[model samples]
Target: MSENVLHLENVTMQFGGVVAVNDVSMDVNEGEIVALIGPNGAGKTTVFNVITGVYAPTNGRVSLRGRVIAEDHPRGKMRKMYAAGHLGEYPRSVNNTPDRITRLNMARTFQNIRLFKSMTVFDNVLVAKHMHLKANFFSTALHLNAREERRMREETMELLRIVGLENECDEIATSLPYGQQRRLEIARALSTNPSMLLLDEPAAGMNPQETEDLSAFIREIKDRFGLTVLLIEHDMNLVMDISDRIYVLNFGALIAEGTPAEIQSNPDVITAYLGVAEE
Candidate 1:
């Protein structure tokens, strides 16, 4: 089996001539933690969108587990042009929905907390679990699959325990403290049993102590679940500490890709984050 779990090849996304991501290519290897970091609008999220099937690239290909999941003008009108130029390489069919992508054992959490505000914390995780149910809707509607429901409930409780949210399971999702709410989001994502996880700014609104706890929590899950992670975050310290490799983007372009130590010493990377003075 290939060591790479995900690969983006020359992926370019243009929104009506406004290029959000330009000819960017990167990879996430099996069982490694990788990070994509850059300025506020450096197309980090755009790349995430393309990879996750939220949008198809104007020109490029995206692969997961060596399978061409999306290619040839994905969600837009760029298909024939792309295939005409690349032929066999771009013949991949478009139109894998976000839900379909999740079933491929890839899951993600948004930068903003997107928990079910009205649902109890437990119910939120249960939602993802129900997706894997084998019972048909007719069986579910008639309450004829009580065993499935019971097993799902047991698994949901186990998942909450693993994420340290067992105590908050009964609370309304939005009622929890900010940090706990974030934990709940992670729990919800994990309910799908994804092999690879994508986290968007998991520490975005956290304080130092919360961030510290979150960093540890992320590592624990990665190790315990035997999962690979690709994250988009701005917390340099956290990124440097946990990531095995880093990819830096600036204005929709990839400027650098390396380890934490290498990225820190690269002059171009320094200039991208902090400007160079006129000499």
Candidate 2:
């Protein structure tokens, strides 16, 4: 019963001599909108990949709630190298596939929109429901799980309504306006029924008005679905307006973490973004 919805403990990712994430650790508590913000090459997305199991940590642990989902380390000669004089920051760790991690009350959307291009909007959302489908293979093959089908339909429609995408249900997923496609991606993620939602650059290509609407929509869904959201965003305005707490990264290391106001004032954060001035 830990209050933290997600925790990354001493996480590090090393490729040969380069450490993409250097002993980075952070927490997302229940019902909080937390953001990871950084300049390009700051390793923000690397942390997300570790959390979602896209890449196992070279060393460190990733946990959702209280269960350890992913852990990794150097292998064979790498192990021997580390043992001799090159120790991984933390220790050996475990790793989980993306799907397995998704089932543990967590789900995420990509930075780029990754919809099923040929599928209808409804089917894109409907496809996520397959994760929670209760019908067995035989029941599914025989179409005997009428109850499950009805439930899935009800769930999908409810999600579409929640995201204001009900009218687009029959449209081709790729044909929707850019903003709606973003909304649809979220709706699809929502269909997985995750308690926590991880959004990567949800405002990437949005205009000021769209970003404004998206910020509001995100907050609305957090309240409506009772979700704890951890987001990676470059839209400073949106990040500042919506985040309860913000974590800043520079060169694969956390430089600051605090409330939005505090993050704004941190000298290190300013330096990271604006760079050092000549003396």
| Highest lDDT against the true fold, candidate | 2
Model 1: residues >4 Å from true position, as ranges?
74-89
Candidate 2 C-alpha lDDT tens digits along 1-279? 338989998787766666678878899999999999999989988999999999987777888888888866677655643321225554656778899888987989989999999999999999999988888999998999999988898899988988998998999999999999999999999999899999999999999999999999999999999999999999999999999999998999899999999999999999999999989
TM-score per candidate, chains pooled: 0.94, 0.94
Please give the clash total of every predicted structure, in order.
0, 4
**Cα lDDT listed for each candidate:** 0.88, 0.89
lDDT of 1 by residue, 68-140 (tens): 8778543445443332223245555565888999999999999989999899999999999977999999999
- Cα-lDDT of candidate 1: 0.88
Question: 197 in model 2: Cα distance from truth in Å?
Answer: 0.6
> Can you give the lDDT of residue 276 in candidate 2?
97
List ranges where model 2 is wrong by over 4 Å. 80-92
Clashing pairs in 1: none
